[model samples]
Target: MSTPPRLTFVNRQGERHARKLSLFGLRALIEEMQCQGVTARAVLSGTGVLSKDFDDDASLITRDQRLAIYRNAQRLAKRSDVALLAGARQRISDFGIYGYALASSRTLGDALDLSFRHLRQAGPVLQITSRVEDGVIKLRSHDPESLGDLLPFVAEFWRSSNLTFLSRVLERPFPSLRMLLPYPAPPHWRAYGRTFNCPIEFEAEAMEWHFAESIWQLPLPNANPAAAKVCQRFCEQVLSEQPQGSELTDSIRAALVNRPGRFARIDDIAAHLGMSLRTLNRRLASEGLSYQSIIDDVRKTLAVEYLERTTLSVEHICERVGFSDPSNFRKAFKKWTGRSPSDFRDADLR
Candidate 1:
């Protein structure tokens, strides 16, 4: 028998910009919170997300924004099973074209491989890796130490939602052999057993899911090579269009963000990055970006974040984004988003 490929998916937290995610997962969480009598406004607090944003199919949120919501859910949820219940509600339709690509694959193995390659399109919060050994497949989640206290909730949500997706893809309950989690069992731990239908072990050395290798070759009922090819192509295009960060750009943005209210000169950034100003310019040009462009992008992102997530005045925001003149900041903000800062904030409130 041919050996299955080893797959590792990493969504590290060090990227310059957070990964953009569809509102599907957020919508599911919001629905679950609503069931617990938690208002959507309460759930979306400090995330710069609005109820109206959910109505737009093309709306996307940054990873940080989503994390803000997750934190809110953790604090406001009245039930311990909120993450599990929210995750369980995920339908294949929630994944959009990514789901279609998985559903049309020839085999479960093909879908796994495709999903691993394009996981960014799926908006995972944790760094996950998988491997096949002997007669079993092991999937592991590498928890980011930065997640600290929020690890359990995020881990539960990720696992449950993924299992739900797998069940729909296989047209049967995904028979996980064993599940190991790094945290202590929650009060509603029984829901884990009911959802996974597998032996659960908490407070383990690592987070892992074990599966029998035979299931890898299971033929998908909706296998359509032509459709899969088209969907995969579209997924690839969407992934490519996503904003990706280079190491230098990430460092530069980190520096810029750390020192708000002052925009670093190109020479300063170049020196900080351990390169000459000319070299920095050349490298940025190679990546189709300019130093001023990055500054503008960063300013625009921060400006919008403040406008939506805070009640800061326009002048205060202008200073925070390194603009000395409020009028220039207003013009730049309008140019970037086609709305003045006040107008944008007011619209978000509605």
Candidate 2:
């Protein structure tokens, strides 16, 4: 199988702050909350999202705002299976044109490849990856440590919703081999067995779903090459038009990179951007970011680029990225991407 293309956005931070996500996922969460007797207003409170936004197909939300809605769902929903139920309720139509592109693909593998390449268009909350190993296809989700207490809920929604989409595309039940989750089993763990119809391993090191290689070759029921091409073109057009990041954030990142080892303080960055410290803080807070977060994001982006595009040694890369201690850099890199520098490079080379 071919690897999906890397995102055009420079880094994770750019992608998250980009205002390109549709309200489909948030709408699903709101509907699920409504089913549980929670009002839409209650679920959207403090999210800076409005109910009328759902009616507009072109309305977009930032990933930060989407997370805010998820946080609210976690707080207001009565049942532990809110994510699962919400995800299960999703149909292909809920995805709009993105769904049509996948459905029109000639084979399941083609659809999976397209989905990964255009994943951001769907407004995903997690970084998903796929690989074929030992005659089995492994689909995994990378947890953003920022999710914090909402990890379990988000993980469940991602897993369940994906299974639902795959099943619908194939016009049959998904033959999942097993599931491995990082978090402990929920109180409604039995629902997982009923939903996936497979073994569930909780408290594992990662979130992954396993399937036999044959599934990849299965022909999609609604394959239409002409339609697939048109829908895919539309997806590409939308992705190309997204704003990479806010002007202020981009300026902050450039300032951080230009300084190299001597990282600028918040006050320095504020002055460089022609704003007071208070204004800088407030602006970043408005975008769900902080000075420290931007610094961390720039460091991670530079480190990953070096690892993937250069032959620099770990120690040398660490020094170049402003880390004085190689050991400390290793820990921070793993925390940022869930992989050591060497391991990340090896995977990239593969």
Candidate 3:
């Protein structure tokens, strides 16, 4: 495989600005606080997270309060335990904010482009970026810190974010995807298995999702074509709310991949990622995949692309894709593309 591009994270103009004073995993934060000895009952009572109108499930703590909670947690714990809360959900959603803004889009790609443009709002702790190489778009994270203990939480968050966005916006099952992580296996593998309906990898440098680039033009749910204007307006507003950026996801992806050797067991990956095996498993389950599946899917996607685009022989391709036996590669290829390697290549050449 070609050396992956060093996806450098750069800043973008703050297109739209608004406030995102707190959102996402508020309940979890509250629950975590209980363990920390700050047991206020609701967002309004114990913390400034909730207002009288904050009873709705959709409401979250304000961005300032969110940061405050993290700061408070750090103070209480006498360490920097609340780093995750440094960024706002509005910014994180900036990655997908365009989708919500669009009344309806033509393809997932169009929506994703918006996501790519705005992912910085989530914070600089983790940044998600993608590059289209050899007909496959590889999405990797940029994180400076190792998220070993937080792998499960991070994995589940990605899975949940992907599922909720795709299901709501596209109104269809996401075509099979590939996930890669550097952490090892977790206990709740089966749960992840069902959600993504694809492979997961622990201890991987990047988590890649493979789909036809053409899918970018697919139409969104709402039939109205005029929605673009509204979507664009909201995009600006979302950016305005959160002027800062994040790269935590990016760091996490990098930490997972830049490991010492080839794929390690989930336990090993988790340890490397600084997360417990169970947490990794449980988080992946929430996303409907496991660490192993992510690795398999990435290999699977690359294998086909290599076969289609290169003159390499079957054995060469197999080796490049980490397959030990030609026969096993053939079997797996058949399952993936429904044709023998020779036939598949010939068809492509034709």
Candidate 4:
């Protein structure tokens, strides 16, 4: 994997330096408060974003702009527990294409993988690293202290949103066994206790949480790996198609997504795009991606959708995804989702 860009600040003459969040993050919080009768201008007053940008799907705003919105939300809330309130109400659907991936994960583990894999979908300044050891599933966030005193609200809003999303996906309240944070308890932090329903370790090494092994194993009713992969590709395409994205990448993705169950080879795609195979390979390599990776991603996606959403046998699904052999497809599916096709289809979500 490529190294993530560093968060560097070189202040010459005290010029401001702040993080940048996607319009997705800004709209998520603002829309929640708007539903509660808060106006966009009221929340984004000093953010320098016009009334027009609030509804623009392609807008990007600075971290200071987001902090201003949060501060206004706190002011309008008039409560110390504003984070919990906002977190409780912030639906994962607020994330657009990303939410579809989370909703269709086969297990909490799958969902976490998708979230961590595309952490930038929430914002550029966020990272959530997760791992499993000794029956404990842990998540450590690099987004802990980016906002100074606004960290508390940011922390709660982030944590509660994840917890709520996890619970909703599993169709059960799956609270953490323990949560770790470096911040001290504020005056009205009871909302934290009420929201998490577990031990909240203050002043810890990092912002982390522990999920019981049982919780991670819980099956999700909407566990369609194929659909989740499609959503993942769509999210990546949208990002790569952004100002920072290459038009070449977007065209490649468009060609791939427009055809389901037809995993096109790089040669075919390149020809379709009216370019030499070597040129197609070079362009995608410039973006640090391989045509094979793209094809495999689509194959994994199609396989899972077939397994979960169709009565077609595994062999049929394998052929549909372009696998010539049943055995080969089974191994690939297991590698993609960490579950065999039979086990995935037979497992009961309840």
Worst 10 residues of 1 by lDDT: 7-16
Compose the digit string of candidate 2's lDDT tens values, residues 104-140. 9999989988887667766676545556778777766
How well does each candidate superpose onto the true structure, as a TM-score?
0.67, 0.68, 0.48, 0.58
The residue pairs that clash in candidate 1, if any, are: none
RMSD (Å) of each candidate, 1 decimal: 10.0, 13.5, 20.2, 20.2
Pairs of residues at least 3 apart in sequence or in different chains that clash in candidate 4: 226-301
lDDT of 4 by residue, 209-294 (tens): 78765565567888898998898788677656533335565455445544445667788888877899999888888889998776
Off by over 4 Å in 3: 1-48, 51-99, 120-125, 244-350
- TM-score for candidate 2, residues paired by index: 0.68
Q: Is candidate 2 or candidate 4 better by lDDT?
A: 2
Give the alpha carbon lDDT tens digit for every residue of 1-350 in model 1: 33344434545444415546767656678889999999999999888999998776456677787778899999999998899999988888778888889999999989988987777677776556667878988887653333657777887887888899888988989879999888888889888889899999999977889999888788999899999999999888877777767757755765666555688899998887788999999999999999898888878877876676566789988988899999999999999989998888889889
Sequence-dependent TM-score of model 1: 0.67
Error (Å) of candidate 1 at residue 63 is 2.2
In the range 1-350, model 3's lDDT, one tens digit per residue, is: 22223343432211112243324434444444555566534323444554332344223234334434444554454223322222112122333335455325555665566555544433322334556766666666533122324445455544545554565567676665577765666655655556666787766755555554555667777545567557666766766665343333332333333431244677876775578989878877776776666566545645665565456689987876667899998998898779989998889789
C-alpha lDDT score of every prediction, in listed order: 0.79, 0.78, 0.51, 0.65
Residue 241, candidate 3: alpha-carbon lDDT: 66
